[model samples]
Target: MADEDLDIRMFVDGKGPPDIDPYFTEIEGAEAIAQSVALRCYTPKGYAPGHNIDAPNDGVFLPDFVQSTMTPHSLFTAKTLVHGEARKVDGVDSARVSVTGDQAAQRMTISVEGEGVDGEFEFSLTVDPSGLGVTST
Candidate 1:
């Protein structure tokens, strides 16, 4: 349900100082998913989203990836692990990534089908002061 997407209000809206874990986790998950998708679609040569010569033109990220688990949160990042291959075989595959989760956990299911690759990618993760990392598929 859309309610599960990312409830920033849960932590905001006069609720409290705002538990940034949810927002941070959601952002990390999104970045990871995009990276995974890019890896699936194919990233450009010397194309990196960084700051240094390799780092892209992105500004200072909310998470400077200081304690960032896998070289600054990514597909391989401990907080987000996207498994299962869903390639667009005929290049017409109706690929869809549906996300669902709560403050406790977040899950992403990627479905792709066209001609070449057909499968489902399920990524489950949880990031919080209580815990962090991909729990399951």
Candidate 2:
């Protein structure tokens, strides 16, 4: 990688859970060199509405408003490097970036001594020059 080609930046757009919008703000403070990319990410959790039930007056007393629990959202990011030449076919140059991590949206159910969320989530990101486009075979 050439020193001028190396760069560090945050990807601004991606596909993920609905309502969870991700926007790349800026790249981390580092040297911008060819084949070199560095960045940090911050993700916020989506807010949900809570339900409440209530009863009043003489007769009988009922619980007023139901208690709700909110789940915390986490963000997992990875930094990777690509060392390969761009493939040119049909007058187009293409490259690929692969990202491996966890899918923050997959929720799992768990019932042990107490109630908890459990599940397996896999994150695999492939950035091709031509997204979802037919390749020259």
Candidate 3:
């Protein structure tokens, strides 16, 4: 897919205003999961292969450490709604947040389904702190 299409968005202030319902029905659980995902961001852990790099600074390269959905091994833990979608009354959307220190970018994916109050929504956020840096190799 194109680069733009691969991007995701996440809400910063945790859950929004009063009317906005968060995808994570349980506030406490959602917060915990979100925090866990945040931890996965670009950490100074792991190794870089093939090159003469001194050591494993901090990078989860393409193939080995790649992760899309919230996998079992993910450092984060979340309590999602029974049916996936957050409650409607809150007016918030579903979301996932991830942090990649190597990329230096925070990503969030929000799915808003309706026009107004009756809309269905969801989101995923990823925080990539790595930015556009290349490993020394």
Candidate 4:
């Protein structure tokens, strides 16, 4: 297996008890990278312990657009931040990011495309006051 980890869905959805067989299922390769990228984009810099020394301030920096209006400049900045973090994943070779928002909904969508060791993958995440949600695309 090429980099394996416990399936995060088991924890995220609070699916039943942990003793079940499915709870311990592992995700590998591109799937693993996709999950990693989603987490990297969601985590704030300095929040994760033992972070990269060179880029101490890694991860997406979501601007406070709740109090203010969302602008093109802010969207562009978000895309850049997400792209930078996505590219830093160990198995990722390249990454592209797109950011769009709905001012009225107070939500932002971030889409990412990347080539990983196993293959190419795409996924999108939504950020709102409630929380962040990820979906594979």
Candidate 5:
């Protein structure tokens, strides 16, 4: 059996008014799990009300962390945050996260590989100071 979720867009370009739709798109299986992992990891700690409160610093602090420094420690921290969040998802059996940064472009890429009920899955997201962009699953 596969999980299903509403296909809501998390990151917006902000070029114009937000896209309004009365109907919701549905996503299923590995894609749904992957999207959940991405959203959880992308959200900053303490931002999500009543979620993961025990682990206060669970979410990625990419915007502030990457903007300030690109040190090895920071990259490791990002990886840990992402990995921890990915592992917490219900369908995930195992998860590995990698965070790489480009100092010149001030961009960071977070990649996740895992095994789930639907089988193996991979997800990646590119984030810059502007915001999160270019997600693949």
Candidate 6:
């Protein structure tokens, strides 16, 4: 994900108790990258929308995550990077980037918790090490 200008930015795109949209905007973004990830992701029950590069709200957003929330980070594999926003919940900043590796195996979940976020679970996404056009809907 760190080549020259490519990156996956995490942020909240929607707000409604019943629904929220997480936007994993591609820094130096690419649409094909998002398409490729859609082909591999195993969206579990309750999440069944469509994958449209131009229509982010139509699909579940995918994001590329790092091995560490700190600096000098090692990029997680595309298969493992879960892209989502880091925001405050009750003053605790938290985020979870993950993937459902195997049905039998526990979902590969990385908890990114720190200051300034209210700890709560809304919507989340995980992206692989792709290019700049991958945006999770």
Index of the highest-TM-score prediction:
5
Cα error, candidate 1, residue 92 (Å): 13
lDDT of 6 at 88: 13
Instruction: Give the lowest summed-lDDT range of ten residues in model 5.
Output: 13-22
Residue 60 displacement in candidate 3 (angstroms): 4.4
Ten-residue stretch with the least lDDT total in model 2: 57-66
Compose the digit string of candidate 3's lDDT tens values, residues 1-137: 22322212232354211122344333322332232222222222352222335444333322122234434343222223211222222333444322222212232222212222323323343222222111110
Candidate 2 — which pairs collide?
A: 5-34, 6-33, 6-34, 6-35, 52-66, 53-65, 53-66, 54-64, 108-118
> What tens-digit string does per-residue lDDT give for candidate 1 at 1-137?
13333322222221222234454434323323333333322222233322124523212221212223323224233222122222312222334333333322332222222221223333433233322233213
**lDDT-based ranking:** 5, 4, 6, 1, 3, 2
lDDT of each: 0.28, 0.19, 0.27, 0.65, 0.66, 0.30
Q: Please rank every candidate by TM-score, starting with the best.
A: 5, 4, 1, 3, 6, 2
> For model 6, how many clashes?
23
Candidate 1 Cα errors over 4 Å, as ranges? 1-53, 57-95, 98-118
Query: For all candidates, what are the clash counts?
Result: 5, 9, 42, 0, 0, 23
Candidate 5 lDDT over residue span 1-137, tens digit each = 62343455433431111132234445556656666666665576755412555556456556665588688988888888778778877789998888899888887888888898878988776767766653546
- What is candidate 1's local distance difference test score? 0.28
Off by over 4 Å in 3: 1-27, 47-123, 126-137
* Residue 122 error, candidate 6, Å: 14
In model 1, the worst 10-residue window by lDDT is 57-66
**What TM-score, to 2 decimals, does candidate 3 have?**
0.22
Ranked by TM-score, the better of candidates 4 and 5 is: 5
TM-score-superior candidate, 1 or 2:
1
Better of 4 and 6 by lDDT: 4
* CA deviation > 4 Å runs, candidate 4: 3-22, 49-55, 61-68
